[model samples]
Target: MQLVVGRIGRAHGIRGDVFVEVRTDEPELRLGPGAVLLTDPAATGPLTVESGKVHSGKLLIRFAGIKDRTAAEALRNTMLIAEVDPDERPEDEDEYYDHQLIGLDVVLTDGTPVGELTEVVHLPYQDLLTVKRPDGSEALVPFVSELVPEIDLENQRCVIDPPPGLIDLAEAELDGGPEQDR
Candidate 1:
């Protein structure tokens, strides 16, 4: 399996080092030094990580053959992909890869069918599950333990405990409810 590990951000300095917006949970392993990453456009390259470091809480990495600011700047917004084993699981049982959660059935804690998990949105602060409802509408459910108490991967279903109007709010936003008036 190929997983997106990070996106190249602007050049960090005059050197070839560029900031990386990490996407994977195992950045230390996936984006570590000497690791080679494939590019999205497929022409930029299978760049090899020559060096990496954290500065000002941001990850900065330098790739082999990319020795100047111009070279690094050209890689901005390019996605970095890594090959992963299909059977490989996270070290922590509670943590799940985005691919693992994408196809599960979504339902309320009471067993009421809600939707199908279509995507996992990774934000800097939190993650969200994009659920495609039976009615063909979509809702963004926060991927927090309190709201999503159980992920029954064995059964291929996830149980959610949404607060009042949590799912409705997403629908309303799409349909222009009273919240839109204010």
Candidate 2:
């Protein structure tokens, strides 16, 4: 499967090195030198990592034949994708691949049906789960260990401990909105 490794940001310097926003936790394994990455726009290129370094916390990478800042700038916003093995997983148990969470049933602790886990949004700080409800609407639930206490892969379910207003639609519907005058 093709997994996103990093996103090419603006050109870092005049030497063809571009700043990268890493998506994968295993940067050394996925974005290291000699690693080949596929591009998103379909034309920029299937870039090969010539060199990589951490500059002021963000990753900077140089690709073969990209000789100047202008060349690197052309690759801005390109997603670097890497071919990954299906059996491979992150070493940390706390970490989860997006594929594992997709399609799992989302439910409350009391077994109240919330929705179906549809997508995982990987932000810089935290991940968010997009749960599609039976009514066809989606809710953005923060994927935190405390709020999302369990993931039963065997049973294909995710248990959520939602706080007030977390799922606004459900909260509104359940409460019938504000008191209305007859």
Candidate 3:
């Protein structure tokens, strides 16, 4: 499936222009006319970009057939997706799409299955992988080499070597304890 790159916000002006909240680092690659966007799976209504430009650090796009403010307003909160092939190479081996990591089985260095990756949280410092354990608990492991030693995307597994006290930190956080205690 094609990964989401942006979402259409409310109409910016009466010229069919709409504000786009960019969700990808490759914003420049996604801009321009004739670009196709899929709003949803069931809604096969592909929106063709009539014109687009980066404005105020966000993408300002106008879609074909959307001429008025009302027409643009109707597209608010619509996710923008393009058909992406899996064979497309990534920018780097360490870099991966959040979708690619989701649902992968998380394991310890010894190969003990801990849980499955439920979500990836992008923070200022680092990305955190939230693993949903079999016991219905959640563990937030930082996506660092020290913590997440290996990722076998093909096998759908990840090996982690969490730093000392990291597990206890996750446990304390799950138990509603203070951050300092963790």
Candidate 3: clashing pairs of residues: none
Model 3 spans > 4 angstroms off: 30-32, 41-44, 168-182
Candidate with more favorable, higher TM-score: 1 or 2: 1
True-structure lDDT of candidate 1: 0.91
* lDDT of residue 102 for candidate 2: 91
Candidate 2 per-residue C-alpha lDDT over 6-103 given as tens digits, one digit per residue, 9 for 90 to 100:
89999987999999988887999999999989899869878999999999988989999899999999999999999988667689877778877899
lDDT of 1 at 30: 100
Alpha carbon lDDT at 169, candidate 1: 65
TM-score each candidate: 0.82, 0.80, 0.79
Clashing pairs in 1: none
State the lDDT of candidate 1 residue by residue for 68-128, as single tens digits: 9999999999999999887788999999988888889999999999999999987879999
Clash totals in order: 0, 0, 0
- In model 1, the number of clashes is 0
In terms of lDDT, the best-performing candidate is: 1
Off by over 4 Å in 1: 13-15, 168-182
